[model samples]
Target: MTDELRSAALESKAWPYEEARKLLKRYPDGKPGGAPVLFETGYGPSGLPHIGTFNEVLRTTMVRNAFHTLSDLPTRLIAFSDDMDGLRKVPDNVPNGDMLREHLGKPLTRIPDPFGKFDSFAAHNNAMLRDFLDRYGFDYEFASSTDYYASGRFDDAIRGVLRHWQGVMDVMLPTLRAERRATYSPVLPVSPKSGVVLQVPVEVVDAEAGTIAFQDEGERIVQSALGGLSKLQWKVDWAMRWVALGVDYEMAGKDLIDSVTQSSKIARVLGGRPPEGFNYEMFLDDKGEKISKSKGNGLSIEQWLTYGPEESLAFYIYREPKKAKQLHMGVIPRAVDDYWQFRGNYAGQAVKEKLGNPVHHVHDGKLPDGTLPVTFGLLLNLVGVMGEGATREQVWAYLANYVADATPAAYPELDRLIGHALAYHRDHIAPTLKRRAPAGVEVAALERLDAELAALPEEASAEDIQNIVYEIGKSRFGEEGGFAELRDWFKALYETLLGSSQGPRMGSFIRLYGVANTRALIAEALAAA
Candidate 1:
């Protein structure tokens, strides 16, 4: 990849970490043209996919995209689902116990899809990315553990695993020191007649129906069939799976960093024929408790999409997958717009400065103006003013209007800019409003409010009303309040009209929306009062 391309990746939140760059240059064609590079990633099917899921795919996609942009020496990206990993516990809204018991101890590929539309659990999880990637334009192959194992890829690897079982344990010894993390157990195949693995202190027993079992020191029993494997534990299985499949690069959250490292050691012992490279991405929402399917506290990618463009969600995940980032509700719409705008500017600068992705020359789309972007908040406010409903075109119009006046001369494509702004607005602003109304006032009670204010010793003139509110807000919110109160008020009005409390500001909002329109809404409130 070109320097500009490398920098473009960095700007979009892809790290040019040492290992990644080395793989970029070498694995595809660096030394006597290495094996066709294979990039892999996966997701757990336990919950709705979140922005973090995008991070995993987007990062891998960037690498895959970069390679595709290059000479195209046969690079492929593969994604999978760990459906067979174990349901462990029920996810919210999903069935529990025996409902999922049918999938217990099997690879996700074997479990039936909970939704029933897909053939198996692996298919369901695979479908999420297939939909997402198709929308985002990433190139990748979809893989499933059940399919791989069933296809006979694991047979030879299983034999190799049996050959190097002890060395695998030695490599993982250092990681098992901590109790919370001491979960790995290496897999070793059985000798046909002896029915026992060579090294580990495991017992072999034969039960009914040609079934075989292996018991570890902890008394954990692993069972298999006469001709197949049901006994390889998860950790060792994770490592050998990669080696068997010839994965060259993969990125995962920090939570799995230790486990993957231990697995790498097993790969080394098994013949050192492992995926040549790996990247340790940071976990998002790391500060907050994990968003297990059990907790139901975390946001999902679909939830993020409801607010804005998929691109912004992609940019956000791209920008901060490895970092501990938070996705508060209503943030993606704005972020999507912003990332596109930033990406546009970054690309422009890179072309001018000769620094980021060269493909940016051909890649269109950029970020929008800040604050003025056509956010969901602003759109809701416009809809609130309309008293009927707003269409996508109307939202786009407001965005264009806002961008035309607010953007500097340096930006010439105001309409396009507005599109970006609206994109961000949709991504970041919540469709639902968060209104914190004044202690006693309500839009419906405005008549009583007016009478109450009018009956006071002196009524506030328009100037006084503006000054009073502005001054009070300024005192509390500082310089930002000069306009923020208007924004908050819109939020309040949105909440009042539509049960959402966030939107455009007062003055500019009214100015752009028109006073006649404002008076109409105010009159309705007064009449109700």
Candidate 2:
């Protein structure tokens, strides 16, 4: 690392840098001969991987990348899947509900695949998680709870939980209500007969021997806690995984705050330190309710990518992670535009400023060259004006006219964005359009704007057209009224002419759409009135 970059990274206040600093403080001397810092992210394979899964790994990677700049220590990210977890309830979103219903209380790895692929339900979901991570080219290792348990990789940690059974219970019991406390045990034994992961309480017969006695179907049963014979409850399981895998860092959603606290205490009981991490607020749906994998209320990873670039999705995940943001179709266009805006600003930024810039983190310090000539918002408006049947060829024709030398080869990002804008307009914008006829002062303003636009030269710049529109609005409305009147004038233009309450800058839109076309649009609005 350059001395300049190292110095700037140490002072950067970006969240990723802040998180990296926490790790640096933990290992001031850099991990004894440069052992790689281990970063972990947990996945419950009860359902298919969703946007939340993508967000956690992406944010964790940003911090991991930040740490690479601050310290020379190598890093390893492990995406752990808790597939040994029992299927408590059928997920609402998946297919073959009847098949999953029959497998409740069994380990997820033992349940039949609902999708008719892979060996088990957990296997199917784990493959999806891997594919999703691989699609984004994330650097990480994959670990499965069932594989670890069955292969004896987790034997030491499992035995540690056995030795500290009471200690683990003491930390967990208080948090549960009276009804739950009565039946709660740190150890959950999988029934040898029924193959169900029994949640009933167990009596520890021998800690050193790893033997536990529990009743099953009115029959006495003795089982060893080691290997795949048993598994810890989720809280204890989480702490055990941290200890077993030597995880240095991990993060979770805000809803897991209490769970983190309870698990941290259990980590100490198992003679290990809890991993350093933070709790980010959860994503909400359009209605402002917390998004759920089961309910499937918000945009999925697949859905977001269909309408926006992957970098935009990464940009969205990188910004203000602590602050809750709504995940929906409406947020996609702005995210795409904001990502390009930051990327465009990256070239001129100083090292210190670049460290704080989100694009640096989004691209892992290598900012993509070239700027998007057209903003995504303007493309959406272009679609709005061109109507629903607009094809890529038609859009490209207009773009080629507005921007000489433009082509799919020269501006590939814009080409992809054009497709995205068409999809977005078809699904979201077209359904919500509410064009109205100009009324009162709006009619006169529209006539004057149209007349002025007609007289302008074909080479009139966006700035020149903007000045004319501004002067007309000021002469007719701004001088006689406050800011509200001028604002409403623009709002009227958007509603009556564009069929939306908000739109791209009028001058930019006019230049791109052709002044003649815009004049015809204004005349159409006037005729409607």
Candidate 3:
């Protein structure tokens, strides 16, 4: 690492850098005997992977990258899937509900695949999770709870839990309701007869023997909680994983705060240190409801990708992670445009400023070239004016005129953006557009603006055109009201001429859309009035 970058990283307050600093503090000498610092992210393969799942891995990767800049210590990220978890209920979004319902209470990895593809339901979802992560080129190893337990990887941890049974109960009981506290057990034994994971009261016959007695079909059965015979409860299992894997860092949503606390205490009982992490606020749907994988209420990763580039999505995830943000289709255009703006600013930034720039983190300090010649908002506006029949050829024609020598071959990013804008316009913007006839003062203002445009020089800049627009609005509306009237004047232009309540800046729009076309739009609005 360069001295300048190392200096900046040491002082950087970006969330990823802050997280990396936590690891530095944890292992001042960088893990004794040169063991790689282990980072983990947990996934429940009960439902399909969603945007939230993507956020965890992506954010964790960002932190891992930041840690590399700060330290030369080797690091590893494990995407751990708790597929051994019992199927509590059928998810609403999956197929073959009857098949899934029949398999309820069984371990997810044992349940028959609802999609008829993978061997089990968890297998299907785990593959989906891996594919999702791989699609984004995330570097990590995949770990399965079922495999870990079946392969004896978690045997020692399970034995440790057996030895500290009371300690585990003490940590967990207070967090549960009275009804739950009565029956909760650190060990969940899989029924030999039924093959279902049974959550029943257990009596520790002997901690040394790793033996537990529990009721099964009115019979008291003695079982060894080892070698896939049993798995720990969610909280206890979390602690066991930490002890077994020696996890250094992990993070979770704010909703898991209590779970993390309870698990941290359990980790202490299991003779392990809890991983360093922060609780990021959850993503909410358009209605401000917390998004759920089962309910599938928010925008999916697929949906977001369809409307914007992955870097834009990464940029959104990188910003204000602790602050709650609404995840919806409406946020896409701005995210796409904002990503490029940040990338554009990255070139001119100092090293310290670069450390703070989100684009730097989004691309792991390797930023791509080119600021978008036109904003996404302007592209959407162009699509709005061109109507549903607008083609890529048609859009590129206008783009070529506005930006000399521009083409799809030269600007691949803009080409992708054009496709995204077209889709967004067709699905979202088109149906909502409702042009109104100009009334009274608006009609005269529209007429005057049209005449002014007709007399403008061919080479008039956007700023020059903007000045003319500002003067027109100020002259027409300044006397009656100040800023409010000026805002209303712009609103009037949007509502009457563009059929929208909001739009791109008038000068930029006119320059790209051609002044003649804008004048024709003004004439149409005035004639209707």
| Candidate lDDT (C-alpha), each | 0.53, 0.89, 0.91
How would you encode candidate 3's per-residue C-alpha lDDT over 374-465 as one tens digit per residue?
99999999999999999988999888657877898788899999999999999999999999998767777778899899999999987788
- Better structure of 1 and 2 per TM-score: 2
Pairs clashing within candidate 2 = none
Kindly list the per-residue Cα lDDT of model 1 for residues 269-380, writing each as its tens digit.
Answer: 7775455445544433434565454455656666655555565666665553445666655455466546545554553464424223222321322233333244344444
Off by over 4 Å in 3: 479-484
Estimate the TM-score of every prediction: 0.68, 0.97, 0.97
Which prediction has the highest lDDT against the true structure?
3
Per-residue alpha-carbon lDDT of candidate 2 for residues 424-462, written as tens digits (9 for 90 to 100): 999889999978998878888888898899899878988
Candidate 1: TM-score? 0.68
Can you give the lDDT of residue 416 in candidate 3? 93
RMSD for each of the candidates = 8.5, 1.7, 1.6
Clashes in each model (backbone N, CA, C under 3 Å)? 36, 0, 0
Residue pairs with backbone overlap in model 3: none
